[model samples]
Target: MKEYIDRKEAISAIREYRGYFQDQKSTDMMLLKMEAENILKDLETFDIVPVVHGKWIYTGKEMWRCNNCDNEIAGYDKMPSEYGVNYCDRCGAKMDEVEE
Candidate 1:
Protein backbone atom coordinates (compact mmCIF):
# COMPACT_ATOMS: atom_id res chain seq x y z
CA MET A 1 0.00 0.00 0.00
CA LYS A 2 1.13 3.53 -0.69
CA GLU A 3 1.00 6.22 1.94
CA TYR A 4 0.48 9.82 0.97
CA ILE A 5 2.59 12.06 3.16
CA ASP A 6 3.46 15.70 3.41
CA ARG A 7 6.97 17.02 2.77
CA LYS A 8 7.87 17.16 6.46
CA GLU A 9 6.65 13.62 7.12
CA ALA A 10 8.45 12.29 4.05
CA ILE A 11 11.67 14.01 5.08
CA SER A 12 11.38 12.54 8.56
CA ALA A 13 10.85 9.06 7.15
CA ILE A 14 13.86 9.40 4.85
CA ARG A 15 16.00 10.52 7.76
CA GLU A 16 14.85 7.57 9.82
CA TYR A 17 15.61 5.24 6.92
CA ARG A 18 19.11 6.68 6.58
CA GLY A 19 19.72 5.98 10.27
CA TYR A 20 18.72 2.33 9.77
CA PHE A 21 21.56 1.80 7.26
CA GLN A 22 24.29 3.00 9.68
CA ASP A 23 25.38 -0.61 10.47
CA GLN A 24 23.85 -2.86 7.79
CA LYS A 25 25.55 -4.09 4.67
CA SER A 26 24.46 -6.39 1.84
CA THR A 27 26.20 -7.56 -1.34
CA ASP A 28 23.46 -5.81 -3.33
CA MET A 29 23.44 -2.68 -1.16
CA MET A 30 25.89 -0.88 -3.38
CA LEU A 31 23.86 -1.72 -6.46
CA LEU A 32 20.62 -0.55 -4.82
CA LYS A 33 22.07 2.63 -3.30
CA MET A 34 22.13 4.52 -6.57
CA GLU A 35 18.63 3.35 -7.50
CA ALA A 36 17.36 4.39 -4.07
CA GLU A 37 18.87 7.85 -4.44
CA ASN A 38 17.21 8.19 -7.86
CA ILE A 39 13.89 7.20 -6.35
CA LEU A 40 14.30 9.87 -3.68
CA LYS A 41 15.14 12.44 -6.32
CA ASP A 42 12.04 11.46 -8.25
CA LEU A 43 9.97 11.86 -5.08
CA GLU A 44 11.41 15.31 -4.53
CA THR A 45 10.28 16.38 -8.01
CA PHE A 46 6.75 15.06 -7.61
CA ASP A 47 3.75 17.37 -7.31
CA ILE A 48 1.87 16.21 -4.22
CA VAL A 49 -1.00 18.47 -5.24
CA PRO A 50 -2.00 18.33 -8.83
CA VAL A 51 -2.33 21.54 -10.80
CA VAL A 52 -4.64 20.17 -13.55
CA HIS A 53 -7.83 18.19 -12.98
CA GLY A 54 -11.11 17.85 -14.88
CA LYS A 55 -13.13 15.81 -17.34
CA TRP A 56 -13.33 15.51 -21.07
CA ILE A 57 -16.12 17.48 -22.71
CA TYR A 58 -17.40 16.78 -26.16
CA THR A 59 -16.56 19.78 -28.24
CA GLY A 60 -17.89 18.77 -31.66
CA LYS A 61 -18.72 15.91 -34.00
CA GLU A 62 -15.69 13.87 -32.98
CA MET A 63 -13.63 16.26 -30.89
CA TRP A 64 -13.23 16.23 -27.12
CA ARG A 65 -11.25 18.55 -24.90
CA CYS A 66 -10.00 18.47 -21.33
CA ASN A 67 -11.69 21.20 -19.31
CA ASN A 68 -8.66 21.55 -17.07
CA CYS A 69 -5.97 21.87 -19.72
CA ASP A 70 -8.15 22.79 -22.69
CA ASN A 71 -6.50 20.25 -24.97
CA GLU A 72 -7.97 17.88 -27.51
CA ILE A 73 -8.13 14.20 -26.60
CA ALA A 74 -9.02 11.33 -28.85
CA GLY A 75 -12.02 9.26 -27.80
CA TYR A 76 -15.26 7.84 -29.02
CA ASP A 77 -18.71 9.21 -28.18
CA LYS A 78 -18.63 7.61 -24.76
CA MET A 79 -16.48 8.88 -21.91
CA PRO A 80 -12.80 8.47 -22.49
CA SER A 81 -12.77 5.92 -19.72
CA GLU A 82 -14.96 3.62 -21.79
CA TYR A 83 -11.87 3.24 -23.93
CA GLY A 84 -9.59 2.56 -20.94
CA VAL A 85 -8.16 6.02 -20.60
CA ASN A 86 -8.47 7.06 -16.97
CA TYR A 87 -6.40 10.19 -17.34
CA CYS A 88 -5.75 13.11 -19.59
CA ASP A 89 -2.83 12.01 -21.72
CA ARG A 90 -1.90 15.63 -22.37
CA CYS A 91 -2.14 17.06 -18.84
CA GLY A 92 -1.82 14.01 -16.54
CA ALA A 93 -5.10 14.88 -14.81
CA LYS A 94 -7.25 12.00 -13.67
CA MET A 95 -10.38 11.60 -15.78
CA ASP A 96 -12.64 11.00 -12.81
CA GLU A 97 -15.17 13.72 -12.13
CA VAL A 98 -14.20 13.63 -8.47
CA GLU A 99 -10.82 13.31 -6.81
CA GLU A 100 -10.22 10.34 -4.53
Candidate 2:
Protein backbone atom coordinates (compact mmCIF):
# COMPACT_ATOMS: atom_id res chain seq x y z
CA MET A 1 0.00 0.00 0.00
CA LYS A 2 1.12 3.53 -0.58
CA GLU A 3 2.17 5.42 2.52
CA TYR A 4 0.07 8.51 2.94
CA ILE A 5 1.46 11.65 4.48
CA ASP A 6 -0.37 14.70 5.77
CA ARG A 7 -0.14 18.01 3.92
CA LYS A 8 2.22 19.56 6.45
CA GLU A 9 4.80 16.79 6.03
CA ALA A 10 4.58 16.99 2.25
CA ILE A 11 5.27 20.73 2.25
CA SER A 12 8.19 20.24 4.61
CA ALA A 13 9.72 17.60 2.35
CA ILE A 14 9.49 19.90 -0.65
CA ARG A 15 11.06 22.73 1.29
CA GLU A 16 13.92 20.49 2.41
CA TYR A 17 14.62 19.32 -1.14
CA ARG A 18 14.50 22.92 -2.33
CA GLY A 19 17.07 23.96 0.27
CA TYR A 20 19.25 20.97 -0.64
CA PHE A 21 19.62 22.22 -4.22
CA GLN A 22 20.36 25.87 -3.43
CA ASP A 23 24.17 25.81 -3.43
CA GLN A 24 25.05 22.59 -5.21
CA LYS A 25 27.38 22.26 -8.24
CA SER A 26 25.71 21.98 -11.66
CA THR A 27 26.26 18.22 -11.93
CA ASP A 28 25.08 17.68 -8.36
CA MET A 29 22.08 19.87 -8.97
CA MET A 30 20.94 17.60 -11.80
CA LEU A 31 20.92 14.64 -9.43
CA LEU A 32 19.04 16.66 -6.85
CA LYS A 33 16.46 17.57 -9.46
CA MET A 34 15.72 13.92 -10.05
CA GLU A 35 15.20 13.43 -6.33
CA ALA A 36 12.87 16.41 -6.22
CA GLU A 37 10.84 15.00 -9.10
CA ASN A 38 10.35 11.78 -7.19
CA ILE A 39 9.05 13.70 -4.22
CA LEU A 40 6.62 15.62 -6.40
CA LYS A 41 5.37 12.40 -7.99
CA ASP A 42 4.67 11.00 -4.57
CA LEU A 43 2.73 14.10 -3.66
CA GLU A 44 0.66 13.83 -6.85
CA THR A 45 -0.68 10.47 -5.78
CA PHE A 46 -2.26 12.20 -2.80
CA ASP A 47 -4.17 14.72 -4.92
CA ILE A 48 -1.95 17.53 -3.70
CA VAL A 49 -0.41 19.89 -6.21
CA PRO A 50 2.64 21.92 -5.30
CA VAL A 51 2.83 25.57 -6.25
CA VAL A 52 6.02 27.54 -5.87
CA HIS A 53 5.42 30.51 -3.59
CA GLY A 54 8.49 32.75 -3.35
CA LYS A 55 10.79 30.21 -1.60
CA TRP A 56 8.30 27.53 -0.56
CA ILE A 57 6.00 25.04 -2.21
CA TYR A 58 2.36 25.40 -1.15
CA THR A 59 -0.77 23.36 -1.73
CA GLY A 60 -2.24 24.52 -5.03
CA LYS A 61 -5.82 24.66 -3.72
CA GLU A 62 -7.16 28.21 -3.63
CA MET A 63 -10.01 29.22 -1.37
CA TRP A 64 -12.69 31.61 -2.52
CA ARG A 65 -14.94 33.39 -0.08
CA CYS A 66 -18.43 34.69 -0.79
CA ASN A 67 -18.57 38.35 0.04
CA ASN A 68 -22.29 38.35 0.53
CA CYS A 69 -22.63 35.34 2.83
CA ASP A 70 -19.10 34.68 4.10
CA ASN A 71 -19.10 31.16 2.72
CA GLU A 72 -15.68 29.68 1.99
CA ILE A 73 -15.01 27.18 -0.78
CA ALA A 74 -11.90 25.12 -1.50
CA GLY A 75 -10.89 22.18 -3.68
CA TYR A 76 -8.55 21.10 -6.47
CA ASP A 77 -11.41 21.51 -8.93
CA LYS A 78 -15.12 22.50 -8.81
CA MET A 79 -14.19 25.97 -7.65
CA PRO A 80 -16.07 29.21 -8.19
CA SER A 81 -14.40 29.54 -11.55
CA GLU A 82 -16.21 26.40 -12.69
CA TYR A 83 -19.54 27.99 -11.82
CA GLY A 84 -20.82 31.08 -13.55
CA VAL A 85 -20.41 34.36 -11.70
CA ASN A 86 -24.09 35.29 -11.91
CA TYR A 87 -25.12 33.54 -8.69
CA CYS A 88 -23.79 32.08 -5.49
CA ASP A 89 -25.05 28.57 -4.68
CA ARG A 90 -25.36 29.10 -0.97
CA CYS A 91 -27.00 32.50 -0.84
CA GLY A 92 -27.95 33.21 -4.45
CA ALA A 93 -26.14 36.52 -4.32
CA LYS A 94 -24.71 38.06 -7.45
CA MET A 95 -21.11 36.99 -7.96
CA ASP A 96 -20.30 38.80 -11.16
CA GLU A 97 -18.21 41.45 -9.47
CA VAL A 98 -16.28 39.05 -7.22
CA GLU A 99 -12.53 39.26 -7.80
CA GLU A 100 -10.33 36.25 -7.77
Candidate 3:
Protein backbone atom coordinates (compact mmCIF):
# COMPACT_ATOMS: atom_id res chain seq x y z
CA MET A 1 0.00 0.00 0.00
CA LYS A 2 1.05 3.58 -0.65
CA GLU A 3 1.64 5.88 2.29
CA TYR A 4 0.52 9.48 2.55
CA ILE A 5 2.11 12.14 4.75
CA ASP A 6 0.85 15.45 6.01
CA ARG A 7 2.59 18.78 5.30
CA LYS A 8 4.70 18.62 8.46
CA GLU A 9 5.89 15.12 7.72
CA ALA A 10 6.67 16.04 4.13
CA ILE A 11 8.71 19.04 5.23
CA SER A 12 10.52 16.94 7.79
CA ALA A 13 11.28 14.29 5.18
CA ILE A 14 12.74 16.92 2.87
CA ARG A 15 14.94 18.26 5.62
CA GLU A 16 16.12 14.78 6.52
CA TYR A 17 16.97 14.08 2.87
CA ARG A 18 18.96 17.29 2.72
CA GLY A 19 20.93 16.26 5.78
CA TYR A 20 21.53 12.84 4.26
CA PHE A 21 22.84 14.44 1.10
CA GLN A 22 25.25 16.52 3.14
CA ASP A 23 26.60 13.47 5.02
CA GLN A 24 26.78 11.02 2.09
CA LYS A 25 29.77 11.07 -0.24
CA SER A 26 27.98 9.65 -3.31
CA THR A 27 25.12 12.12 -3.65
CA ASP A 28 22.80 12.06 -6.66
CA MET A 29 22.84 15.65 -7.93
CA MET A 30 19.67 15.35 -10.03
CA LEU A 31 17.65 13.83 -7.18
CA LEU A 32 18.95 16.48 -4.79
CA LYS A 33 17.90 19.24 -7.20
CA MET A 34 14.44 17.72 -7.62
CA GLU A 35 13.99 17.51 -3.84
CA ALA A 36 15.10 21.15 -3.44
CA GLU A 37 12.51 22.27 -5.96
CA ASN A 38 9.81 20.22 -4.24
CA ILE A 39 10.76 21.75 -0.88
CA LEU A 40 10.40 25.25 -2.32
CA LYS A 41 6.98 24.45 -3.79
CA ASP A 42 5.75 23.04 -0.48
CA LEU A 43 7.05 26.04 1.43
CA GLU A 44 5.20 28.42 -0.89
CA THR A 45 1.96 26.48 -0.45
CA PHE A 46 2.24 26.96 3.33
CA ASP A 47 2.77 30.73 2.89
CA ILE A 48 6.32 30.48 4.16
CA VAL A 49 8.95 32.98 3.11
CA PRO A 50 11.47 31.61 0.66
CA VAL A 51 15.08 32.41 -0.10
CA VAL A 52 15.52 34.85 -2.99
CA HIS A 53 18.87 36.20 -4.21
CA GLY A 54 20.53 34.65 -1.13
CA LYS A 55 18.05 36.29 1.22
CA TRP A 56 14.85 35.09 2.86
CA ILE A 57 12.16 37.36 1.44
CA TYR A 58 8.96 37.97 3.38
CA THR A 59 6.51 37.57 0.55
CA GLY A 60 3.59 35.20 0.30
CA LYS A 61 1.53 34.30 -2.74
CA GLU A 62 -0.39 37.44 -3.70
CA MET A 63 -4.04 37.41 -2.58
CA TRP A 64 -6.96 39.59 -3.66
CA ARG A 65 -9.58 40.94 -1.30
CA CYS A 66 -12.66 43.05 -1.70
CA ASN A 67 -11.89 46.63 -0.69
CA ASN A 68 -15.29 47.48 0.69
CA CYS A 69 -16.29 44.30 2.49
CA ASP A 70 -12.82 42.87 3.14
CA ASN A 71 -13.85 39.57 1.61
CA GLU A 72 -11.10 37.34 0.31
CA ILE A 73 -11.44 36.86 -3.45
CA ALA A 74 -8.60 34.50 -4.30
CA GLY A 75 -4.89 34.26 -4.89
CA TYR A 76 -3.30 35.90 -7.94
CA ASP A 77 -3.49 33.15 -10.57
CA LYS A 78 -6.87 31.90 -9.33
CA MET A 79 -8.52 35.27 -9.85
CA PRO A 80 -10.58 35.82 -13.01
CA SER A 81 -9.12 37.97 -15.80
CA GLU A 82 -11.91 40.55 -15.38
CA TYR A 83 -11.64 40.65 -11.54
CA GLY A 84 -10.10 44.10 -11.71
CA VAL A 85 -13.35 45.57 -12.98
CA ASN A 86 -15.83 43.32 -11.25
CA TYR A 87 -18.01 44.35 -8.35
CA CYS A 88 -17.59 42.88 -4.89
CA ASP A 89 -20.21 40.19 -4.23
CA ARG A 90 -20.72 41.21 -0.64
CA CYS A 91 -20.80 45.02 -0.73
CA GLY A 92 -21.45 45.85 -4.38
CA ALA A 93 -18.33 48.06 -4.42
CA LYS A 94 -16.23 48.06 -7.57
CA MET A 95 -13.14 45.93 -7.19
CA ASP A 96 -9.93 47.87 -6.82
CA GLU A 97 -8.29 48.33 -10.20
CA VAL A 98 -4.78 48.23 -8.76
CA GLU A 99 -3.00 45.45 -6.92
CA GLU A 100 -1.42 46.36 -3.63
Candidate 4:
Protein backbone atom coordinates (compact mmCIF):
# COMPACT_ATOMS: atom_id res chain seq x y z
CA MET A 1 0.00 0.00 0.00
CA LYS A 2 1.06 3.57 -0.63
CA GLU A 3 0.24 6.71 1.27
CA TYR A 4 -0.66 10.11 -0.09
CA ILE A 5 -0.49 13.40 1.74
CA ASP A 6 -2.60 15.41 -0.69
CA ARG A 7 -6.34 14.80 -0.85
CA LYS A 8 -6.73 16.10 -4.41
CA GLU A 9 -4.04 13.76 -5.65
CA ALA A 10 -5.75 10.91 -3.91
CA ILE A 11 -9.02 11.79 -5.57
CA SER A 12 -7.30 12.10 -8.95
CA ALA A 13 -5.65 8.74 -8.43
CA ILE A 14 -9.01 7.15 -7.77
CA ARG A 15 -10.46 8.81 -10.85
CA GLU A 16 -7.59 7.57 -13.00
CA TYR A 17 -8.15 4.11 -11.58
CA ARG A 18 -11.79 4.50 -12.45
CA GLY A 19 -10.73 5.23 -16.02
CA TYR A 20 -8.64 2.10 -16.15
CA PHE A 21 -11.54 0.08 -14.86
CA GLN A 22 -13.87 1.72 -17.36
CA ASP A 23 -11.45 0.96 -20.19
CA GLN A 24 -12.07 -2.72 -19.47
CA LYS A 25 -15.77 -2.04 -20.13
CA SER A 26 -16.93 -4.06 -17.16
CA THR A 27 -20.02 -3.36 -15.06
CA ASP A 28 -17.89 -3.94 -12.01
CA MET A 29 -16.67 -0.40 -12.45
CA MET A 30 -20.01 0.91 -11.27
CA LEU A 31 -19.68 -0.85 -7.97
CA LEU A 32 -16.04 0.13 -7.76
CA LYS A 33 -16.82 3.75 -8.41
CA MET A 34 -19.42 3.70 -5.69
CA GLU A 35 -16.89 2.25 -3.28
CA ALA A 36 -14.23 4.76 -4.29
CA GLU A 37 -16.62 7.70 -3.96
CA ASN A 38 -17.72 6.47 -0.58
CA ILE A 39 -14.13 6.33 0.57
CA LEU A 40 -13.40 9.79 -0.69
CA LYS A 41 -16.50 11.18 0.92
CA ASP A 42 -15.50 9.79 4.28
CA LEU A 43 -11.85 10.70 3.96
CA GLU A 44 -11.95 13.35 6.68
CA THR A 45 -14.00 11.41 9.22
CA PHE A 46 -12.16 8.13 9.71
CA ASP A 47 -8.47 8.92 9.71
CA ILE A 48 -8.48 8.38 5.92
CA VAL A 49 -6.20 5.41 5.76
CA PRO A 50 -6.20 3.39 2.56
CA VAL A 51 -4.46 0.12 1.87
CA VAL A 52 -4.02 -1.58 -1.51
CA HIS A 53 -3.06 -5.22 -1.46
CA GLY A 54 -2.57 -8.26 -3.78
CA LYS A 55 0.87 -7.40 -5.01
CA TRP A 56 1.88 -10.88 -3.94
CA ILE A 57 -0.30 -12.41 -6.63
CA TYR A 58 1.45 -13.21 -9.88
CA THR A 59 -0.08 -11.16 -12.70
CA GLY A 60 0.36 -12.39 -16.25
CA LYS A 61 2.70 -9.98 -17.94
CA GLU A 62 6.06 -10.54 -19.62
CA MET A 63 7.76 -10.34 -16.19
CA TRP A 64 11.37 -11.47 -16.36
CA ARG A 65 13.67 -12.76 -13.69
CA CYS A 66 17.36 -12.97 -14.35
CA ASN A 67 18.22 -16.59 -13.64
CA ASN A 68 21.86 -15.81 -12.94
CA CYS A 69 21.33 -12.86 -10.62
CA ASP A 70 17.74 -13.12 -9.44
CA ASN A 71 16.83 -9.61 -10.54
CA GLU A 72 13.24 -9.06 -11.62
CA ILE A 73 11.93 -6.77 -14.35
CA ALA A 74 8.31 -5.70 -14.62
CA GLY A 75 6.89 -5.92 -18.11
CA TYR A 76 5.33 -3.09 -20.08
CA ASP A 77 1.91 -3.33 -21.69
CA LYS A 78 3.37 -3.52 -25.20
CA MET A 79 6.40 -5.54 -26.13
CA PRO A 80 9.44 -3.60 -27.26
CA SER A 81 9.53 -3.39 -31.05
CA GLU A 82 13.24 -4.07 -31.43
CA TYR A 83 15.40 -7.19 -31.13
CA GLY A 84 14.96 -10.44 -29.21
CA VAL A 85 13.73 -9.68 -25.65
CA ASN A 86 15.84 -11.99 -23.55
CA TYR A 87 18.50 -9.47 -22.59
CA CYS A 88 19.36 -9.82 -18.90
CA ASP A 89 19.96 -7.19 -16.25
CA ARG A 90 22.58 -8.74 -14.01
CA CYS A 91 25.14 -11.19 -15.26
CA GLY A 92 24.19 -10.36 -18.82
CA ALA A 93 22.52 -13.74 -19.15
CA LYS A 94 19.99 -14.11 -21.94
CA MET A 95 17.00 -15.25 -19.94
CA ASP A 96 13.54 -16.21 -21.03
CA GLU A 97 10.79 -13.61 -20.56
CA VAL A 98 7.93 -15.61 -19.12
CA GLU A 99 4.34 -14.45 -19.18
CA GLU A 100 3.57 -13.94 -15.50
Candidate 5:
Protein backbone atom coordinates (compact mmCIF):
# COMPACT_ATOMS: atom_id res chain seq x y z
CA MET A 1 0.00 0.00 0.00
CA LYS A 2 2.22 2.80 -1.25
CA GLU A 3 1.16 6.43 -1.23
CA TYR A 4 2.00 9.33 -3.52
CA ILE A 5 1.55 13.08 -3.70
CA ASP A 6 2.06 15.76 -6.30
CA ARG A 7 5.50 17.06 -5.33
CA LYS A 8 5.09 20.28 -7.25
CA GLU A 9 1.80 21.02 -5.57
CA ALA A 10 3.17 20.26 -2.15
CA ILE A 11 6.09 22.55 -2.72
CA SER A 12 3.82 25.31 -3.89
CA ALA A 13 1.59 24.93 -0.85
CA ILE A 14 4.54 25.06 1.53
CA ARG A 15 5.89 28.11 -0.21
CA GLU A 16 2.55 29.83 0.06
CA TYR A 17 2.24 29.03 3.75
CA ARG A 18 5.73 30.31 4.48
CA GLY A 19 5.08 33.46 2.53
CA TYR A 20 1.77 34.09 4.24
CA PHE A 21 3.38 33.88 7.66
CA GLN A 22 6.52 35.80 6.88
CA ASP A 23 5.48 38.73 9.05
CA GLN A 24 5.00 36.64 12.20
CA LYS A 25 7.56 36.92 15.02
CA SER A 26 6.12 34.57 17.67
CA THR A 27 8.41 31.75 18.80
CA ASP A 28 5.99 29.00 17.85
CA MET A 29 5.35 30.63 14.47
CA MET A 30 9.09 30.84 13.86
CA LEU A 31 9.58 27.18 14.66
CA LEU A 32 6.68 26.22 12.41
CA LYS A 33 8.15 28.34 9.62
CA MET A 34 11.52 26.62 9.98
CA GLU A 35 9.80 23.23 9.84
CA ALA A 36 7.94 24.34 6.77
CA GLU A 37 11.21 25.36 5.16
CA ASN A 38 12.67 21.95 5.90
CA ILE A 39 9.58 20.34 4.43
CA LEU A 40 9.99 22.42 1.26
CA LYS A 41 13.61 21.28 1.02
CA ASP A 42 12.58 17.66 1.33
CA LEU A 43 9.83 18.11 -1.23
CA GLU A 44 12.28 19.61 -3.70
CA THR A 45 14.67 16.70 -3.48
CA PHE A 46 15.04 13.98 -6.09
CA ASP A 47 11.99 11.99 -7.03
CA ILE A 48 11.44 8.41 -5.80
CA VAL A 49 9.67 7.23 -8.90
CA PRO A 50 9.16 3.62 -9.89
CA VAL A 51 11.52 2.09 -12.40
CA VAL A 52 10.01 2.07 -15.90
CA HIS A 53 9.91 -1.51 -17.10
CA GLY A 54 8.83 -2.68 -20.54
CA LYS A 55 9.41 -5.19 -23.30
CA TRP A 56 10.80 -4.87 -26.76
CA ILE A 57 8.26 -3.84 -29.40
CA TYR A 58 8.72 -4.97 -32.95
CA THR A 59 8.79 -1.96 -35.26
CA GLY A 60 9.93 -3.50 -38.51
CA LYS A 61 11.30 -6.71 -39.96
CA GLU A 62 14.82 -5.80 -38.89
CA MET A 63 14.25 -3.42 -36.01
CA TRP A 64 12.85 -3.58 -32.50
CA ARG A 65 12.42 -0.68 -30.10
CA CYS A 66 12.42 -0.42 -26.35
CA ASN A 67 8.89 0.14 -25.07
CA ASN A 68 10.13 2.22 -22.15
CA CYS A 69 12.52 4.46 -24.04
CA ASP A 70 11.82 3.91 -27.72
CA ASN A 71 15.48 3.27 -28.35
CA GLU A 72 15.73 1.06 -31.37
CA ILE A 73 17.92 -1.97 -31.87
CA ALA A 74 19.00 -2.73 -35.43
CA GLY A 75 20.26 -6.05 -36.72
CA TYR A 76 21.46 -7.03 -40.11
CA ASP A 77 21.51 -10.83 -40.16
CA LYS A 78 19.40 -11.76 -37.15
CA MET A 79 16.78 -10.27 -34.87
CA PRO A 80 17.91 -8.21 -31.90
CA SER A 81 16.71 -10.83 -29.44
CA GLU A 82 18.96 -13.42 -31.08
CA TYR A 83 21.85 -11.33 -29.82
CA GLY A 84 20.94 -12.47 -26.28
CA VAL A 85 20.46 -9.05 -24.75
CA ASN A 86 19.00 -8.91 -21.23
CA TYR A 87 18.55 -5.13 -20.99
CA CYS A 88 18.13 -2.16 -23.22
CA ASP A 89 21.58 -0.92 -24.19
CA ARG A 90 20.44 2.69 -24.48
CA CYS A 91 18.02 3.25 -21.57
CA GLY A 92 18.88 0.20 -19.44
CA ALA A 93 15.28 -0.98 -19.15
CA LYS A 94 15.17 -4.56 -17.88
CA MET A 95 14.21 -6.80 -20.81
CA ASP A 96 12.14 -9.37 -18.89
CA GLU A 97 8.63 -8.68 -20.21
CA VAL A 98 7.15 -10.50 -23.18
CA GLU A 99 8.55 -9.55 -26.59
CA GLU A 100 5.96 -8.09 -28.95
Candidate 6:
Protein backbone atom coordinates (compact mmCIF):
# COMPACT_ATOMS: atom_id res chain seq x y z
CA MET A 1 0.00 0.00 0.00
CA LYS A 2 1.21 3.58 -0.63
CA GLU A 3 2.01 5.72 2.41
CA TYR A 4 -0.42 8.55 3.17
CA ILE A 5 0.86 12.11 3.02
CA ASP A 6 0.02 14.59 5.79
CA ARG A 7 -2.97 16.86 5.14
CA LYS A 8 -1.03 20.06 4.36
CA GLU A 9 1.36 18.26 2.04
CA ALA A 10 -1.54 16.44 0.41
CA ILE A 11 -3.39 19.71 -0.15
CA SER A 12 -0.40 21.38 -1.76
CA ALA A 13 0.17 18.39 -3.99
CA ILE A 14 -3.48 18.35 -5.03
CA ARG A 15 -3.32 22.03 -5.99
CA GLU A 16 -0.26 21.38 -8.11
CA TYR A 17 -1.87 18.30 -9.64
CA ARG A 18 -5.05 20.22 -10.52
CA GLY A 19 -3.01 22.88 -12.34
CA TYR A 20 -1.21 20.15 -14.26
CA PHE A 21 -4.46 18.33 -15.08
CA GLN A 22 -6.03 21.58 -16.31
CA ASP A 23 -3.09 22.16 -18.62
CA GLN A 24 -2.85 18.52 -19.78
CA LYS A 25 -6.01 16.48 -20.24
CA SER A 26 -4.35 13.15 -21.22
CA THR A 27 -6.25 9.99 -20.08
CA ASP A 28 -3.37 8.56 -18.01
CA MET A 29 -2.70 11.94 -16.37
CA MET A 30 -6.40 12.37 -15.59
CA LEU A 31 -6.54 8.91 -13.98
CA LEU A 32 -3.58 9.70 -11.71
CA LYS A 33 -4.95 13.14 -10.91
CA MET A 34 -8.33 11.63 -9.98
CA GLU A 35 -6.63 9.11 -7.67
CA ALA A 36 -4.82 11.94 -5.91
CA GLU A 37 -8.11 13.82 -5.55
CA ASN A 38 -9.81 10.74 -4.06
CA ILE A 39 -7.08 10.51 -1.44
CA LEU A 40 -7.49 14.20 -0.60
CA LYS A 41 -11.24 13.69 -0.29
CA ASP A 42 -10.63 10.85 2.18
CA LEU A 43 -8.50 13.19 4.28
CA GLU A 44 -11.44 15.60 4.34
CA THR A 45 -13.63 13.08 6.24
CA PHE A 46 -12.12 14.30 9.54
CA ASP A 47 -12.77 18.00 8.84
CA ILE A 48 -16.56 18.42 8.82
CA VAL A 49 -18.34 20.25 11.71
CA PRO A 50 -21.98 20.76 12.66
CA VAL A 51 -23.21 24.33 13.16
CA VAL A 52 -24.65 24.52 16.72
CA HIS A 53 -26.44 27.81 17.26
CA GLY A 54 -26.14 31.59 17.80
CA LYS A 55 -24.12 31.79 14.58
CA TRP A 56 -25.37 35.12 13.23
CA ILE A 57 -26.93 38.49 14.11
CA TYR A 58 -29.10 40.96 12.21
CA THR A 59 -28.56 44.73 12.64
CA GLY A 60 -30.44 46.13 9.66
CA LYS A 61 -33.82 47.89 9.93
CA GLU A 62 -35.37 50.09 12.60
CA MET A 63 -38.11 48.69 14.86
CA TRP A 64 -41.68 49.23 13.65
CA ARG A 65 -44.52 50.28 15.96
CA CYS A 66 -48.20 51.24 16.11
CA ASN A 67 -48.93 54.79 14.93
CA ASN A 68 -51.18 55.31 17.95
CA CYS A 69 -50.29 54.59 21.54
CA ASP A 70 -52.48 51.53 20.76
CA ASN A 71 -51.47 48.20 22.29
CA GLU A 72 -51.05 46.53 18.89
CA ILE A 73 -47.86 47.02 16.85
CA ALA A 74 -46.56 46.24 13.36
CA GLY A 75 -43.13 45.61 11.93
CA TYR A 76 -41.56 47.94 9.33
CA ASP A 77 -41.34 45.13 6.82
CA LYS A 78 -45.05 44.26 7.15
CA MET A 79 -46.58 47.73 6.83
CA PRO A 80 -45.00 51.03 5.80
CA SER A 81 -46.61 54.51 6.00
CA GLU A 82 -45.58 58.00 4.89
CA TYR A 83 -47.37 60.12 7.54
CA GLY A 84 -48.84 59.59 11.00
CA VAL A 85 -51.52 56.94 11.64
CA ASN A 86 -51.65 55.71 8.06
CA TYR A 87 -53.04 52.39 9.26
CA CYS A 88 -53.71 50.51 12.43
CA ASP A 89 -50.30 49.62 13.87
CA ARG A 90 -52.18 47.23 16.15
CA CYS A 91 -54.80 45.01 14.47
CA GLY A 92 -54.86 47.44 11.50
CA ALA A 93 -56.54 50.20 13.54
CA LYS A 94 -57.92 52.94 11.27
CA MET A 95 -57.69 56.75 11.83
CA ASP A 96 -61.13 57.12 13.49
CA GLU A 97 -60.12 60.30 15.35
CA VAL A 98 -61.03 63.13 12.92
CA GLU A 99 -59.07 66.41 12.79
CA GLU A 100 -60.11 70.12 12.32
lDDT of 4 by residue, 21-100 (tens): 56655667767866877788776633654322111112348554444565566654433223354455445554444446
Rank order by TM-score, top first?
A: 1, 5, 4, 2, 3, 6
Model 3, TM vs. native? 0.27
Which predicted model would earn the best TM-score? 1
Write one digit per residue (lDDT tens) for candidate 2, span 4-93: 667566555654565645788867876766676566667555474432211111134665666666656555244454554345557765
Per-residue lDDT of model 6, residues 38-82, tens digit only: 777776334433322111111236344443443443344433343
Q: Residue 7 error for model 1, in Å? A: 4.5
Per-candidate TM-score against the hidden true structure:
0.49, 0.29, 0.27, 0.29, 0.41, 0.24
Give one digit per residue, the lDDT tens place, for model 3 in 20-96: 45745545744775676586566534343322211111133655565445655555554433435356556665443
Worst 10 residues of 4 by lDDT: 50-59
Residue 12, candidate 2: alpha-carbon lDDT: 57
lDDT of each: 0.67, 0.54, 0.50, 0.52, 0.70, 0.48
Show model 5 residue runs off by greater than 4 Å: 1-52, 76-79
Model 3 residue 14 distance off true place after TM-score fit, in angstroms: 78
Better of 4 and 5 by TM-score: 5
True lDDT of residue 75, candidate 4: 59
How large is the C-alpha RMSD of every model relative to the true structure? Answer: 9.2, 15.4, 15.8, 17.0, 6.7, 17.3
Candidate 1 Cα outliers beyond 4 Å, as residue runs: 7-52, 98-100
Q: Residue 19: error of model 3 in Å? A: 90
Better of 2 and 6 by lDDT: 2
> After superposing candidate 4, which stretches have Cα over 4 Å from the reference?
1-4, 18-25, 45-100
lDDT of 5 at 39: 76
Clashing residue pairs in candidate 1 are none
